[model samples]
Target: MGDHDINEDHAQASDAPPRAGDGPRTAQAKGAVSRWTRRVHKIYIICFHRGFAAFLVLPLVLALVFVAQKNHFGADQCKARESGCGFVGNEDAYGLGIRLGVYLQWLSVFLVVYLLPSEERSLMTSLITFSSALMMAILVLTFGGTCTYTVEIIVLLWTAFMTQALASITHTAQEIDDAGIREVPVISGLKRATTFQLNLDSPQGMHGFQSGSTLVEMCILGYAAWFWVCLLRGAEMVFAATPCGTSLFFFARIQDRKGIVVISALMTAVSLATLLFRLAAWIFRTSVKRWFSKRTYDMLGAVLVSIVYLPITLIAGITYLVPDTWMLKMFPGSGGREQLMVFLCAFVAFIVSVAGIELLLVWNGISDVYGVGSTGQLIPLTMGLVSLMPILWKLLRRYMAGEPLVPEPASNGSGLLIRGTALPHQGSPVEMAARQSDREALQLP
Candidate 1:
């Protein structure tokens, strides 16, 4: 009777219910959710595959067919003309148009990569940046048009937008986590938490190819797309004079008469200044990228550089494109002419100033990254050297080509001075002076 009672009690207790913190039941629920998520992931992958194939392959095939049909040549036509006929050919712009389309295509790809659920985004960003860089290089080398540059600018802007969106999402998710919150609290908080944790573990939260991505996350990811767009447009204004005939169709802004006059002048100046500064940065290897965390400095520097680039480009562009007669009319003949010269001088001065800013930015980057003092010490030399190299190199090369070398003001490190002698070629006076200056710079305490 006692044994029977004991057995019945044990069965009843087991049948009553499972207690809280039952590991097996929780594990089973997790397993089921994992299966469902996996299925969803598979479907997403398939969708992406289809989209890529349709968008990329189909368009490529159609483009090839269209080009062939439009540009076909007749075999008998050449024989008819003893002298080769200057047959009507396709516009170079058409080719540029195709290239522009390709760039936009890549931009679209980046958008998808950036917008996809987080787990797959890292791989996508790596593929996107690398691929786009190659395409950009190709466009730069071959097409070399304002249209090409415009596309490049657009792509960069798109990248900024994508980055900001990712950052915003990441920040929001983090905030949610800190609040011990679920995105959909009503739909099983534990499951949502588990899924979120899974996303964090995946590439969705971390990118592999990006440098100082943590800093990037802190810097760029939390920002909005509009801010990035403004910066990109500002940067684009630096080289605003170049004809982007078709690109205007895509990205141009209409202006009132007074506004047009003002904007044109501003853009031209900014563009010229930015271009000169970029040249200086390249020559000196005084990249802001070297001094600071690539992500942080790039984001911050981007803002300042863009602001400077915009107004300058507008001025230069206006000066170049506007009728000289009209420009001369705007200010009285003597005063306007003087103002024109002043504008040119100011643009040049701006370039020199920004070159200094760029060098300082570089030094800051180096200090931040490597704890190196070399950058700080070399800052002034880098600034002066970079600004001078382009003007000197261009002039020297021109002189070598037997072109008349018009003298421009070269800095004596004390003040701007007229050259007493021509700039050197193969150990010329200027070369010797530069070497001596460099030596003195290197010896600085």
Candidate 2:
């Protein structure tokens, strides 16, 4: 049962006389509860604040490296097949670099949020987390008009989804923290579940949650709309990339008056226009027409697109990676062709990424640097992997250990947000039990 239910029961009980047996039982429970809560609190308090700081620092440093390497060369496969000397026909690589910059800034915001004490991460943290998502979603929408590579589209959508998922998890954590949930609910034993699900849509779930604010409503609506748009756009991209996918897409288009193309153009135009408007609002306060301060609109947009839609995009992206078996069942040989194209496109992208980084290193006057003669070709790849090492290490360690390598900011913060709506202001029962036991046993009030 939820905390509110428990509170109601207590209120009802208070109106009636207590049973003769209750006083002794209540007294007996107090000592044990006090002892447990005290000990558990100490155990959870053993957090490595420094570790969280380090996590934030590494991403920021690498993000800078990624931005500096913005100069791009053409995709190697395109250079080999189309032009003898060089090719600059497609600006995909350039776009990818810019997107990475966007990714870096978003990542920094996420990390900075964790730097503050969990309790302090209120609506502002929610904004920061969701805004990062919105920025990326808009970028994807803006680019959806032109991008058609099968593998690249898959990667872009996949990355978008994963980033948003992480952001949502973080946002849920902040909400829980704000709601004063110090302990995650217990399902099994004395051990606590590190991560539990939280239902962001539930106002009653959070103790002090109030959703009367226009910003919150906008966030909910905006996120839902963006998610719907991205899913449609991703489908369109898939259709455009594959021959089999395209034939069906066009047939559908024939039925729907070329809807995919229209969506692509409309989405790109609106996303671009929204960005420009945000800039104009900031510079000249043009959002005065909306009757709210320009700042409020900014906040509203952040919550809607970044927090809500970002995660939805991620969920949709995962569906795209589903096996082509359904298509194969319809046509025996078509799947193989699509698979080959994907592999080739992936290879092209890998070559392009490495070349872009290497060119940047050379351009910055790093002559014949660390890996030039023997491992020259591998230099860019090496740095890229190195930049990702910190994140990779944690993920790999978690995989091997079957648990998180580092503790979350809250005792129960590391894992999934449990789909909970109402929790007591004190925390879950396990938290209450532990806290009570600790305090009583240790002679603390």
Candidate 3:
């Protein structure tokens, strides 16, 4: 009996299928899955907080501006040994039209990135890019402006469209159930209708949860108004000085003074409207206090990173990491890295505060740090310097006040939203409370 039983058991063991994790192929498959999961996690992290990350492109924008300074195309500042070539003032209105256009471009980008989330975010960003591209395309066709930013805008537009298409695949939402609280899915796809409505929609009206905000958005709104007013006045000067803009609006080939004022006024109206929306957004941000706290620091850090490092990274990647046919045309020089390096050195000097060195060394001395072949081609050198003053001033003020360089984001880690159908085991009171909050966050109506 014993011998037959032992023989039967050995036979059953031999006949059993190999375990899932035992073979080389299984190991390889597991490894591949792990790698893919990690890659996805990385992408989500990088893309999710892109508003703060937008500062990374600041250097690229600067590259577009100062590329003209590397050649003979720039103004008197190009001729000076010190390179902070503020706009050549030879043009009417100290070139305020150009100034207005450039600052608006930066603000437009910041708003799109900062205001929205996921597919909605990308769509808005793409819409803004499309409008700018259309305007720039017309301007280039008629008169002239930098094509590099146009190309960048188009690329971003395409990326946003692609992101919109893939949003469902990348993002996932979980359901939160509060025992009796997870009663019913009231409004189909909307958040759940709970017994007691969540405070997220209404007011919390307490400052304890929020950190130092200074209502920076409101401050920026006021600043934008002042800036646009100056720009409008400057536009008036240019329009009075030259009638080309308004004439072109009506398709008249000859230069006409009336057209410039009309065109400038139209642009002023659009700029004011844009600022109004931004103001509304900032007001909305006050309600989401914890989510939007430390906004100024985020803005400052992003700007500094863009100003300090983006050019070097873009150039290196353009040269070594990606194909370079378009970059060569966009940058018009191989010497950009050197200029960027020099700028870095100057920044370092400013940091050390060596021997009573003036800010002119850092502020007005960064021109001619980019283009190599831009002698008579697309020179945006002058207004480029002016465009950054608003952001830089904001950052420097924050710096002097001893505020944080890199802002710490508020944690919204509490919540009980489970991703799937599995029920949770018994846990402590704190754990149960966290789970309940998670469901409340989902608020599945």
Candidate 4:
């Protein structure tokens, strides 16, 4: 009888079905949620691996190779495969030298920005960083060579300014005349588009960014380059005036007074020409003029370009003739020269910094402005200050509600159950009661 009872109990336990309160629906819901989540995750992974490569990665690699070539020579020589010498060293390497100079100045700017980490950088920022690095690497190649300190300074500042300008344009512009809107050039096409994807007739057509911002970025870059050239000329002139003892041998051996005078004259003419060119460009949107006139605008831009060329031509001319007095005349005076120079440099730096800051602000406001706009420096500073308001409000609300400064999960045992459904405890109530009774009986014995 005892064996039969035990057999009957085992059979009953085996035949019994699960209770309806086991939260089977909740389990099924969780399974559905998990499946969707996995699908989304897989899509993201595929996009990252394939799309990033097809659109962004391959172009970057090509740009890097070009950068490597420029490090050895300049941008000009990178494409010159015919120059008998396969690479090591070549003649009149100064043009490449100037390119190297631009790279270093930008490096300092990059370092300063990192001091305050902003939110995550976007594709535009990454491309700018890459381009800047490449430019800097090229500059380093010319570190101890024949390029003068003045030339290096000018190049560095100009290069950095250019990189920043390009970044702003690439991020904001909807399309270039060539590149389709969908696949824009992130950095290389600052002034104009150079990427393969910039086809004009694609479905993602270009709508063009704000003309104002583009003009500003271009102007800033132009001015930065001009400033470097001026500083270089002025510094060179000053050094010429105070030749050290070591310069005596070379000074005496070479004396071409007429050549120096002619060179100086040519440089002056060029400076005037560049100034004219700048004026014309500012007035007339076109790169080429329809007609020539004696208008002051055309004259000014021509003068500035001419001026940029002047220092080189001027220095070359004076290498033999004018002597130290002429140089001193060209350099800015030395009455507290250190203080004056600092103030001037700072002023220019402030303007460039503002250019960068304004770009981000305007981009955020892009939707309303048709991806084209300019905000005052004051506006950016104000916006940056105002961004803090939301963060502060969140904090204040938390404090007022008497909510724990940090979140604390509920402490009730029953409340520990998840939100959607209730799950019953395992085992039948009758079985639990019988087990308790058996325990009581044992204690009594």
The reply for model 1, stretches above 4 Å from the true place, is 1-119, 122-445
- TM-scores of the models, in the order given: 0.21, 0.25, 0.20, 0.21
Local lDDT at 396 for model 4: 59
- In candidate 1, what residue range of length 10 has the lowest lDDT sum? 241-250
Best by lDDT: 2
TM-score for candidate 3, please give it.
0.20
In order of lDDT, best first, we have 2, 1, 4, 3
Let me know the TM-score candidate 4 reaches against the reference structure.
0.21
Task: Give the per-residue lDDT of model 2 (tens digit) for 1-445.
Answer: 2345323422432323345667876855564344333323222221111112222233433432343123222354323423222222222322334334334433433332332122222423343343445445434533344323332332333333333333333434334333422322212211211222234444334312211121222232233334335445545322122222221121122113256446545544543333333333233222233676646754554443443235434543453465668535432342232333333344444344434443432222222233223332243234333334444453464346454322222222322111112212254565445333322221211
For residues 178-237, could you state the per-residue lDDT of candidate 1 as single tens digits? Answer: 222111221232342244332333332221112122223222211212222323344433
Runs in model 4 deviating more than 4 A are 1-152, 161-174, 177-217, 220-278, 281-445
How many residue pairs clash per model?
Answer: 29, 29, 15, 38
lDDT tens digits, residue span 1-445, model 3: 1234323422432323346757987765565444433333322222222222122333433443354223222233224422123312221111233323333333333322212111222333333333334333322321232211111222222222222222211111111111111222112112221233422222121110010011221222222233234334543221111111211222233234455446445544543443343333333322333455456634543443344344444553443443345434432233333223333343343233221112221222223323323332122323333333544453454356554322222111111111222214235665345334433332333
